[model samples]
Target: MARKRGLGRDDVVTAGLAVLDHAGIDAVSLAAVAERLDVRPPSLYAHVDGLAGLKRDLAHTTTVEFGEVLRDSVLGRSGPDAVRSFADAYRRWATGFPGRYEMTLLPIAADDDERRAGARLALGAVQAVIRGFGIDETSAIQAGRSLRSALDGFSRLENADNMGRGDHDADFAFLIDLLIDGISQAGTQPPGPA
Candidate 1:
């Protein structure tokens, strides 16, 4: 196999993301990425450790991006409006990049500082949404977890075409509205980090 010029770690990762997005995780391999980059499969090792290392990098990159997207979606908004925007953005990102979104479910080892940092950003965004409901520190963590659970379940169901015969958009809207109403009834305290 001939060496491909201008190949780099980012190039390999970009190719991996493209292939993963286009053909799903099962199609993402060193050979596929190298083929996308017009390089030999062995050439990828010069940039990434191997397939596992490449996947780790992909996970880290996508997690950070996911956090940023969620955080940005609610910027300049507050309360129920913020919750709506954040929830909608969550679904959009998940559906848009289903393969990368799946990476969020995998373990990010405690010692992996970069991945941990990314996870923190994501957690912070979720916590902020729950806090927007005026949930205090005492309830933010639980509320955040609950919110994530709801979103994850619906997203997975929708992606798999298992959301029954109902209108998904209406069901999602109702779910968000239910959450807003419940949180609103819980008492409106000032928003703060848990």
Candidate 2:
């Protein structure tokens, strides 16, 4: 019979996410998680290589969770309806889980499993949106980048409490509508000047 691992990697990752959700990313150290789990800091090495590894895993986990939210929100929808749903989900995820949402801004690296996982999750969300418009892969990627930029910008601003006074919800809605119009135009635009 195989010996059971005391603190599985997934458990550590999950705990790390909890730490992130409750506190900010900076508070999620192996020692911190160890304290939360009532284990020695050294014991965490068996489950996670180090703090960096934990951060990577947390990023991967956050992305996967975000992907599920997007999938559920955008499925069976199309056109502006899908776009609006996706945008709302994205904003909700960001506002609801600020620390996890901040992980999306981390720089991706080659040869990193977490990076691949994060990419997969992000791409899955984009594909969900792309499917709504029946866009090709190239166009989908472009549109995805645009949508991500817009959402990220708005969320970051809001999280920083820089949205400024006067009906932020109205402003957010207008931005979403603008993005939908932009995406629609891009979908129908002809290639290059004649």
Candidate 3:
């Protein structure tokens, strides 16, 4: 109970993530994390402000972690290939860590710079795909929003086992192809008279 040598904020975050993985978001409490770390609850206050602070940290950490997953997935890919890789990476992460994935969507204030940047990093992955499609800045924002929404909706449904029983893998592949095709066509479309 001597502060557990080498224990730090990252350790707390890792412990919290473990709790999240095993028992869901609601199970991630200071006491739970402390217990996981073999320390008392008050000891956690030294590493994290409190439950709210811990959750905030967890949100930022997980957002970045999710973004890293995305970025890594498309490291050598571009265009429709990046799109497919991004989609596959996202679904795998969402389904693998449903609790943490939900935390990524939690509402946070705009002033939360670290959290905002982490979230943006994840979105940046999608923007990379949009960029591959040659979409301009004006169109990229809208395109990113649509792609994120579609991916989130599909992942949530698929994670909840609500995607029906007709080979979900194929369903996801088809969905990705449809998204890529849509983006490809949009890129080729002549701009409307303006």
RMSD for each of the candidates: 3.0, 4.2, 2.4
Q: How much is 149 displaced in model 3, in angstroms?
A: 1.0
For model 1, how does the per-residue alpha-carbon lDDT over 77-172 read when each residue is reduced to its tens digit? 878898899899999999888888887777887777898888887787777777766656666666677778888998998878887896889999
Tens digits of per-residue lDDT for model 2, 71-127: 788788888888888899999889889999888567766777756775676677677
Q: How far does residue 21 in candidate 3 sit from its true spot (Å)?
A: 0.8
| Clashing residue pairs in candidate 2 (N, C-alpha, C atoms within 3 angstroms) | none
Candidate 3's displacement at residue 150, Å, is 1.3
Q: Deviation in angstroms for 4 in model 1?
A: 1.8
Summarize candidate 3's per-residue lDDT along 20-134 as a digit string, tens digits.
Answer: 9998899999989999999999988888999999999989988888988998888878998899899999999999999899999899677899888887778778878889889
Per-model TM-score, in order, reads 0.91, 0.85, 0.89
Order of candidate numbers by lDDT, starting with the best = 3, 1, 2
- Which prediction has more favorable TM-score, 1 or 2? 1
Show model 3 residue runs off by greater than 4 Å: 1-6, 190-194
On lDDT, the stronger of 1 and 2 is 1
Best by TM-score: 1
Q: Model 1 segments beyond 4 Å from truth?
A: 188-194
